[model samples]
Target: MTDVFETDDPETDAGATVLEVRFTGDEGRLDRALALALPDLSRARLQALIAAGAVSLDEAPVRQGSAAARAGLYRVAVPPPESADPEPEPIPLTVLFEDAHLIVVDKPAGMPVHPSHGHARGTLVNALLHHCAGSLSGVGGVARPGIVHRLDKDTSGVMVAAKSDAAHAGLSALFARHDIDRSYIALTRGAPHPRAGRVETRLGRSTADRKKMAVLRNGGREAITDYATLRVFGPDGRPLAAEVRSTLHTGRTHQIRVHMAHLGAPLLGDPVYGSGGVSPVVREAVAASGLTGQALHAAVLGFVHPVTGEALRFESAPPPAMQALAAALSAL
Candidate 1:
């Protein structure tokens, strides 16, 4: 059946181009019908659009691609493509050190390092673009200029950015060689069985959930973490929570969180890897402390200056929420 396509010239909402399609008879399947109607868009893209609720039938949102196609008016809202270059934003940064080649800042929790699919603004890169005033190195490309490494959006702590191309290369080399010293403080339920040791494993994307990282028996990359239990709260024999310190020898995506979870000591408030029951006291403390995300902080970062060859080390204490949670846990 031939479908009539009506294109809207003006973007009426959120920079999305709206296409109106009218079907006269059943078209077998919605995705197949949409793909035939919108020849420019791939069938896979149409199916994704339908799943994302960007396609509507008779003004009602359509969420399933396999739904039967009936004679009706279908509206497809195609979102605009993201910009190639990130715009600078006037967001405040806690600068620890700054010089001709590099800048270090105490990045707070909840701030993403760079712009991504759902997060297009209010990122560290946007703030640094404004702070550096176009002086940042372009080695990491336009999307993430000067970013040598990254911390997860919800993991708070020290981060260094390169201001010069030489510094960027040097810092990247240092990280690649595992010469940089990185330490994190994690508040975890229970504790590692041995209390202090090294966790070495192959880490990769989870087979079940592609969005999350996991420990793999084969394949994947090598990830190593040297951890020690700093302190445990609650009862002596059966502690409720413990403060753990992890030192990274090899950096991988979500390395610390996944390793800790594998060791039966996932970080508190970690939404992805932290699963299992928590004590009522700990739950109450978490609510009271206002710790919304994972209780993992990049407590220390030490490395030789890439350009100057001077030793540099920066340390940051946990944020207010962590401090409050620790206090509450201690009192238990």
Candidate 2:
């Protein structure tokens, strides 16, 4: 049965009337309360609103840093009008391979992989939902039906989605065991020493900024990235382009960017972990290719079919930006 709640009376514009909500003793957190009461909004966005003094309890403003509320009867104020609609927008996608068990898509950069705070619609998942016509498997959840893994919003590449529960389980297991073969192509500022090597580091949340991840010695997970320089040259023999392929033994947040930066080579357009801006030569080359964001792509993905047990491999060419960069480097 769908969860239901009474809406605040429309007569009062002090916002909606205060609706008294009695916690069941277990689900009393402000975030949980808002989630239960307002099922339409995402948990992250609701939490942000609560943190920003937009949500009050019993007319008393709740502290942003406060933990979940204890079991009690509290009045929650209705939120203000939203400035933007989170409705899904239809977008085109490139399908590399599709079957009853899975789908491999050539995801584009700048398009979010899933719906999130500012990106409520026009996501890869939303487009898939529309294109697949409700045929996607409900393995993860209603919101994330066939999702098994995710790529960052700005990262473009080949991603797979399970079309059935069995496929979902099988794919999840493969990823957990590091059995899937995943390869990425990246354009960094400088060539790596030795031209080919592996980087092993422990990564954890940054102490200085909770929002960022960093390589940490004491408290972090082990991350392994094996990279080989595919090509290295410069516009005037000054060392401009470095094309490297990275294979992840252990996936960690910002592993490639962090490890690359650690090796004195950072991704060209990464704003957070590496250099924030792009070089003039790199910018001109990338613009010719008509692409924005970082020059990274999931060029290869390989795995066994969940049902047939047959080996399957998929590869995608670099997007325009990456291609343009390659051509410019070739001339150099």
Candidate 3:
């Protein structure tokens, strides 16, 4: 059900459309009206378009999706969907290990694992395509070939990609069974109570915010993390923050971030979950560190070689931003 809407705009891409919607519903939501007017577009997609400033009503920008629909002409610009087959880009990769069956690399922060809506280029997939020269496994699909698992876009760490289908299947099975050793280092706003403990919760999409993952009381996948405070920083009398090492027993989306936030000690610089007061000194250090996002890093990854039956493990230190942040916190 690919909707390819053509428009008269000369600059529009092949599948792009510029919709002119005439809404007369006075009480209906703008997004709902647009969705009804353009049956091809989903209501969620319409809402996103409205939020992205892609929709204008009566020659004025409409910022709210829930605004009351006015009797006016609305114009919506629908950008063309990204191509399923991502073209290869010659992005540099820090290769840790490579073979005919698999490749391991230390992925840097800000690099997405694959192409998505806002990140359609310069991803790890594009780099893998160029590096592997089209020799990657297709089991993960064309867009995300060989991707058995993923770290968040802002999280830096070691990653493995399979180059053969056998390796892909074996690695996928290992992840499914939770047989991989995965550990993360998080610089947190405050220390979690009990210094060392296990966090087990059911995690799912938040009912209040669809874009966020939350801890649910029921009806979600189980997530577990074993964590310990490696070091506490700040004045001796008052602990302002701590360095945490979290080992995952189950991999769920944003598992570490959500769990840490649930403990009232979210990671530093985490825009989504880290929403609380911080010591002025620590905040200044975070600013000085120049970290664009959360201070979380995938510090360790260990697994048995899927095809070769060899033990393999990889470790990576935190990036410069996190290191600087740690140093600053230590001085506090």
Number of the top-ranking candidate, with TM-score as the measure: 3
Residues 79-160 of candidate 1 have per-residue lDDT tens digits of: 8888989999999999999998999999999999999977899999999999999999999999999999999999999999
Give the best candidate by lDDT.
1
* Cα lDDT, all candidates: 0.92, 0.75, 0.90
Candidate 3, 48-84: lDDT as tens digits: 8888888887779899999888887788888878888
CA lDDT of 188 in candidate 3? 94
Cα-based lDDT at residue 261, candidate 1: 89
Model 3 TM-score (2 dp): 0.94
Q: Per-prediction RMSD in angstroms?
A: 2.4, 8.1, 3.1
Off by over 4 Å in 2: 1-89, 235-238, 276-279, 286-289
TM-score for all predictions? 0.92, 0.73, 0.94
Lowest lDDT block of 10, candidate 3: 1-10
TM-score of predicted structure 1: 0.92
